[model samples]
Target: MSYKTIVVHLDTSARAQARLHLAIEIAKRHGAFLQGVFAVFAPNPRSFVVMAGTAEYYEEHETVRHEEHGALERLFEAELSRAHVDGEWIDETGNADDELPKYARRADLLIIGQDDPADPESFVADHFPENMVMSAGRPVLVVPYAGSFAHIGRRVMVAWDGSREATRAVHDALPLLKQSEQTTVVTISAAHGNVPGARPPGADIAATLTRHGVKVTTLDLPAAKDVATGEMLLARIDDIGADLVVMGGYGHTRWQELILGGVTRTMLSSMTVPVLMSH
Candidate 1:
């Protein structure tokens, strides 16, 4: 019911500091071991095919990579020291989107930043945040690209669909939800009504959370055919003024070419608050 270790992805991006600060706060709160992972992809050999010289291309790329890694390491150390959190820094040479998930297996939770499309260089991978969430077996906390969140898990919103994925997300978020001042579980039901033999939407889960000492409330909304599920959830998050959102990241695609579910993709692309997702 508590995070023992937290792994955070670090990079030389504008929003990296915001993510680090949030991660530090969480680590301090839980008294967890904090780890900062910097995955620096080595120069792609394929790109040399178009260039006249391979040596020069690799030399320049290596230099930039080393410089970036050093900068990230310095920032990681400084922040951890200032926060006085038990922490470690890891530097790896590989595709960030791939390596990060591997690192996540050892940690109770993983923290990563939302991709900023306007800043192409800010992306850690081709699909970035989505790829990490889909691959990491553990829960992931994705910090927004624009906003600064000084506090998290104070107010929470859970998007429930009554699927196995939803169940996993709810359970995975138990520690945070239990600490939240208020937690709202929003269920999107079919327009018809409750399905046969199923408990009322959100009722069972809300009761369960109440037993766990969470200040829980339930809200039922009819699913709209024309609107995407992610849009509905985002609107609800705004309505409730939630600082954090917990939900399942459902998706179907080959590992090489990921195609995220509509809701998963939309939330990653247009999230206003931090989101904790479990696949």
Candidate 2:
């Protein structure tokens, strides 16, 4: 489907310009309506933790929060001023991971930065992919902090798992796939040594893409590294010099703090190109 209303999850960090640039290009490429989103805590998440602090402390917290909101808005405004495409700005004050998807569930796509969680300052896991993907069920395009993508159609990579979420990510990314000069479907081990029948039905997928007139190529490789499939995909993306990588978002969280076997977490940390994914 063509993206008409794309929502980008903007991390309010000093280096957020790269994320904004990629989002602008995607929006223009699809002629899509776009919105820049920043997650915030409503009633403040810190209120629960900092209750015992002095009045002066709470005032400082509130001031800092207000300034953050303002800074985010201005940053986006500046980016949009340089962007050839036009879009709206959005800010939601609440627990970031919770607030984003809860309000913008039906958006055509979600774009966010892919930064490491261990850096003590990465936005990838720190923001809210876990909650957003599980709830929104919309594709998320994750870009590494050192972004360098301009247009996404030169060469494309699709990481296929044949699961429901993977299926969703692929279909959601079809618009870009169709526009790509070449597209490769890279699937991790389907058997996993456990289920001989675990592989995705391939001929049907090839037929489906053929119907779209997509220049599609398919390869199912054995799991080679200790790295998760998502990480493998991004590694291949860089190796292939791909402009865009498409894959399914695997895994979900129970409650708020726990996560399961999703490859998204790893991909986000190390990716260097633009990636399109759906939950």
Say which candidate scores most in lDDT: 1
TM-scores, each model vs. reference: 0.90, 0.78
Instruction: After the best TM-score superposition of candidate 1, give how far the Cα of residue 159 lies from its true spot, in angstroms.
Output: 0.3
Q: Where does candidate 1 stray beyond 4 Å?
A: 45-65, 191-200
Residue lDDT tens for model 1, 1-279: 899899998877777777888998999888889999876435467778787898686888677867877887888789888878999998766788778888899889999988887864476667778877888899999998888798899999999877777788889899899999999999877733677457668988999999999999888887888987789989998789899999999886675678788889899989999999999
Per-residue lDDT over 1-279 for candidate 2, one digit per residue giving the tens place of the 0 to 100 score:
798888877654544666677778888888887898775333444556755665566687668757866776786777677766678887664666666775457678887666544433344344355556666767777666664665666788777656787688778888888888888777766434424455443545756887998888776667765666665666687666688877766665556555645467666556667767677
Q: Please give the lDDT score at residue 33 for candidate 1.
A: 91
Q: Which pairs of residues have clashing backbones in candidate 2?
A: 40-93, 40-94, 41-93, 41-94, 42-93, 42-94, 139-278, 140-277, 250-262
Q: What are the candidates' C-alpha RMSDs?
A: 2.7, 4.2
Error at 13, model 1, angstroms? 1.5
The C-alpha stretches of model 2 lying farther than 4 A from their native spots are 41-75, 78-84, 116-127, 189-203, 224-231, 255-257
